[model samples]
Target: MPLSAALLQTLHSIVGDKGFTTNQGEIAPYLQESRNRFQGHCDILIRPKNTQEVAEVLAICNDENIPVVPQGGNTGHCGGAVPQGGILLNLSRLNKIRQLDGLNATITVDAGCILQNVQLTADKADLYFPLSLAAEGSCQIGGNLATNAGGIHVLRYGNMRDLTLGLEVVLPDGQIWDGLRALRKDNTGYDLKHLFIGSEGTLGVITGAVLKLFPKPKARACAFVASESPGHLMDVFAYMRDYFGEQLCAFEMMPRFGLDLVLKHITGTTDPFAIAYQWYGVLEISTSRPNTNLQTELEEALHPLFDRGYIQNAVVAQDLMQAEKIWALRESMSEAQKREGGSVKHDISVPVSHIPDFLAETSHAVCNVVPGSRICAFGHVGDGNIHFNISQPETMEKAAFLTNWEALNEIVHEMAEKYEGSFSAEHGVGQLKINEMDRFRGGVELDSMRLIKRAFDPNNIMNPGKVVKI
Candidate 1:
């Protein structure tokens, strides 16, 4: 709905000159989705300085039936942050470390606080906040919590939903719901924070949150192991987890093709192993205690893989720099993939035990549908999530290869459903997978979701046409 002249004047009065902008040049960055796949437009973009200003703006928009798109750092991949019209609520100015209870292992931060900054704050206090993502440097806590972002450390620390304990939200009607309790166990009527956590801003605007923290790991060890197959890598993973326990913070899998892409496209990237192997698994074991000898524990546990012929070789990082370099290969996969052209990325997960079977079947099915499609499959296999991305065939045109997005999504999602997996794993429905929510989610599930959305946002002024359609 277009903002009335009176409404625009009133909004301008509420935020003042520094807070509001109608200039397209200044608003250009906030209008684009991360992949350049979804481009949205807005009449005005407002940078609210505090919760009161946010509430005031939301109240005006809600009263006028104007949609409000609450955005963080605009680093989301699924177009959740993209605004169609009405007001774009830019929360970057609201970034402030509200509180920190190091003794209790809890850190309270504003919605727009950059994730990397939060990590550093925790580190400064001799604690750790484990909600790490690739775009952590720019991705805001609000977006991370809204999407319930899953990252490399999910296997050890859980997702954003788990890391978050409480949230302060600006409701659809402009009322601030302060549920930021720092308690570990609360037998409340309902877990309201979880609703807004993964709601993708459809329910309400997440203004602030109290996140859980953990003791910083003092002893750390990393290994880059080569496996003949994913199943074999899982075998080694099982053994390592049994021996290393909670110290196994990360277990990332990378295909040879993925590594090759990084080596070719990204400068200063060197092969961890002398000879390229079919599959590579990067493992990191760490503990708060010093002199844990996690390296030996990981090494001994991996010895059986050779006898089973699952793993052929392994390289343990002797220093911090080498460990980082080894990790760079895994972290560089997505950027390197961009150079390959017309990539169809899937952030899907199956049961930890079923990963090998799912990969084998899904790769076969994807190949059947798009023959010669170069598969660049990798991700956190310890937690069952797989970044099953496919790059376009070298011979195909970029536009021509992208034409298979729909067919390819169906094939991959159907296979995941057969194995009781999600079509959209960590990345929220946003605009990308809203249609799939209907195709995959049960009727009762969809109905329940809509019912909740209606109960909270009957007018649907908050983030319209995203997540679930009412």
Candidate 2:
């Protein structure tokens, strides 16, 4: 059904003329996600300035039965931000750091604040907001909260879910749920804020949040080492944790192919060591106090493995710029692969013990299904989350490569089930993964999700046809 002129006029009035745009050229950018894989067509794009404006927009849309898609920086890998022929309610204009309570170690920020900005704000106060990602420069805090984003820090700080103390949300029917209390121990009830954190805009729109902060690290060191397998990496991880439990900040894994793609496409990059091994592990250690030698700590912890040949070679970054150079190689994997060809990406997780089996089996299955396919599997190895991505064979056509998406996804997702892993790890189940969810999610689980959707959004006016397809 087409929206009435009066309803569109009301929405335009709430956000003002400058805030609304119907031009296809202007709306086209906001309609698609980062990967350019999922595209949506929206009738209007509304840039709301504050929580009250967001509530007003939702109120009008809800009354008129007009669906609304809440979007942030629009850097999501999943189609979580794409609209479904409705209004694209962008929160970028709502960029504001409401408060920074140094005593409490909490920062209250508006949804649209860039994630890196938030981190920088905390850094100025001798604090840290440990949600580090490759897209932090472009992604927003609301999107991070929406997807419950996990990055390299999950090994020590956990994901976005653990970093967030509370949230302020605009509900489906235009009511505000002010659950933004920054108390550490509030086991008061059902923990409703969590439901909206990873809900992906199905239940409501996130307006603001109170995020947790940590002490800034004074000593830090990064190392690139070669491990024989996940098992050997696991042993190394266990050894490090025994001595530097919380200090071991990040543990990332990269297959040889992933490293090759990075070296091939990204300039100013080189091998960290003299020898190129089949598998590589990037590890970092940090401490909040000064006068600590992280390099010495890592060297001591890894001496046994170094002697036993479990690790082939290692390079420790001498300075901050060198540390960043080492990390740049890891961060450029996705884009480097994109330069090669189309990619099929799966963000999944398995038991810490079963990562090797999952990788070996899934690699074998995908290769058998599509011969000559290049696999670039790399991600946070500490939490067992692997971004299992495959590039089309160099000789194949892009159109023909996408045709095998379903077959490849089936093989990988089935193995995820066998290992008792999640098909959708940090990336939520947007429209792109609904069919996969239907295959994996139990009937009762789906029914309960539906019940909640019906309870919160009876008319289904909030991002309709996303995340379980209400």
Candidate 3:
């Protein structure tokens, strides 16, 4: 159903001329995601400046039964923010830092504040915000909270759900729920904040949040280690986890194929090791105490792993610059795959011990189905989230390879399920993996999700056709 002129005019009145745009050119960017895999259409794009404006706009949309797609910074890998029809309610204009209590170790801000800006604000106060990712410079806090984003540092500091203390949301009926409490132990009934955190906008619009902060690390050390295979790397990870304990911040793994792609496509990046190995691991350890020689400690720790033959070769970064260079090899893997050709990506997770067997069996299964496909699997193995991405064959066309996306996804998702793992780990269930929810998560689990969706949004006007189908 098309939005009536009266409904559009009423929405315009709530936001005014500067906050609304019907121009197709201006609205083009908001209708598509960063990956360009999903594109949608909206009659008008509405940028609400504050929480009250957002409430008013949503209230009107709710009354008219109009579909409203709430978009954050639009950096999501899944198509969560892509608008289907009706109004595109963007939260970019709501950017503001409401409060910063350094002593309490919390920062309160509007949901539209850029993630990097929050990190910088915390840095200025000599504090730290540990939720970091590739899209931190552009992705908004609301989207991060909505998707419960997980980055490399999840091994130590938890994901966005753990970082968030409280949230202020505007429901589908335009009623504002003020649950923004910064208490560490709030045994209040039914922690409502969790409902919207990973709900992916199916419940309500996240307007503002109070996020937790941590002590900034005074010393840091990182190393890139080469191993014969993922199985060997897991042994190394186990030893390091016990040795470093709380000091261990990150542990990432990638195949040789992933590194080759980065070295070939990304400029000014050099291989950390002289000889290439089958698999590589990046481990980082940090301490809040100043003047700690983490580099020496990390170097001394690798000696035992070498003795055990768990690692083939290793390069411990002596300086900050070298550490970043080592991290670049792991961070740039996704971008490097794009330069090759069509890549079928999967954000899946399994038990830490099951990672090796899962990778080996899944790789074999994928290869059997799509012969000659290049498997570029990598991610935060410390937290058990692996980005299993497959690139097109050298001899195949990009379009032809992309057609195997669903088929390859089934094989990978089935393998993940067999290992008692989740198919969608960090990425939320947008339109992309809604069917997976039904296939993998059915009966009581899926039925409960639908019951909550209908209760919160009976009209289904809040991000309709997302997360759970009604």
Candidate 4:
């Protein structure tokens, strides 16, 4: 149902003319999702200036039983940010670095603060906010907290869910829950902040967050290593981690197919290795101590793996520019896939030990199902999260290839389930994986989630029909 005239006017009043918009042109960007898989419609987009304004909007929304989709930078892979109806609560105006406690190693910021801005602020303070993703430049910290986003540094610093210390949220009934305590340890009742973080705004709108910060790394070593086969990455990663330990930040894998896709499609990319290899991976080690010879450490550690015939060829980035160039190959996976054609992607996780076998088996299975289907498998192998993306067969029609989405999802997700891995890893369930909740996740686990959703959002006015169903 369309919002009543009075209700719309009230929402407009809640946020001044500058903060509210009914025009389709201005509202179009909010509806155009990151993946472009879904485009949502909202008659009005409300941009609240502060937590009080957000609470006021929610009070009106809850009373009218209006569905509100809380949106951040709208750079999420899942369509969780996209609203079905009701006015969208655009939190971009709330962007502000509220506080930065360098001594305590915490930074408090409004939810609308762009992730890169926070990172830049942390850098200025000689500290680090390690939750780094490709869309950091555009994505917001609130959405990151809401989705519990995981990026390359998850192996070291943990996901946004782990990095966050506290959250201030507006409840479904318009009550502002100020739980933003920047404490390392607080045994004060149940941790309510967790309910909103990674909740995908189904329960409440994340207004602000107190995020944990880490010591700035003085030096980071990067390398692009080639494995004889996909199966060898497990042994290779083990050798590197055993040597580097907590200093190891990331270990990402991209197949030759994925590399070729980037080379063929993207500009200014070069082949780091002299010969083409079947499987390629980028491993990084970071340390806070200054003048640490990470290159010498890498050389000493690589000799053993090289002698064992596990490593095919490798090149450590000589400088900052070279390091970024090496890292670019990994970051360009998604963009290159888009340039190629339709991609059916999976952000799933298995045991670190099972990654090699997982890639080999799943890739073979998918290719068999759809002949000529190019597999562009890559992502954070250090923590077992693989972005197993399958590009449509070049010869096949895009529409026809897309029809196999369910079939392909079944093949990939089923194998992940069989391997005791999660079907949805970093990317939350959102609308895309809602059905998978029943198929992969069931019984008591799902029951508890539903009960909590009903408890916090009894009316289900907050981000309805996204993560869970009643």
Top candidate (TM-score): 3
Clashing pairs counted in every model? 0, 0, 0, 0
Candidate 3, residue 198: Cα displacement in angstroms equals 0.8
lDDT by residue (89-197, candidate 1, tens digit) is 9899889999999898999999999999999999999999987788999999999998999898998999998898899999988999999999999998998998999
- What C-alpha lDDT does candidate 3 achieve relative to the native structure? 0.93
Over 172-255, each residue of candidate 4 has an lDDT whose tens digit, in order, gives: 898999998999899989999888888999999999999999999999889898997767877888888888899999989999
- Deviating ranges (above 4 Å) for candidate 4: none
lDDT of 2 at 365: 93
TM values, all candidates: 0.98, 0.98, 0.99, 0.98
* Residue-wise C-alpha lDDT for candidate 2, range 217-291, written one tens digit per residue: 999989888887767777777777777888988988898899999999999998887777888888999999999
Q: Could you tell me which residue pairs clash in candidate 1?
A: none
**Superposing every Cα of model 4 onto the true structure, what RMSD results?**
1.0
Instruction: Pick the lDDT winner.
Output: 3
Runs in model 3 lying further than 4 Å from the true structure = none
Better of 2 and 3 by lDDT: 3
Give candidate 2 regions above 4 Å deviation. Answer: none
What TM-score number comes out for model 3? Answer: 0.99
Per-model lDDT: 0.89, 0.88, 0.93, 0.90
Choose 3 or 4, whichever is better by lDDT: 3
lDDT of 3 at 441: 93
Off by over 4 Å in 1: none
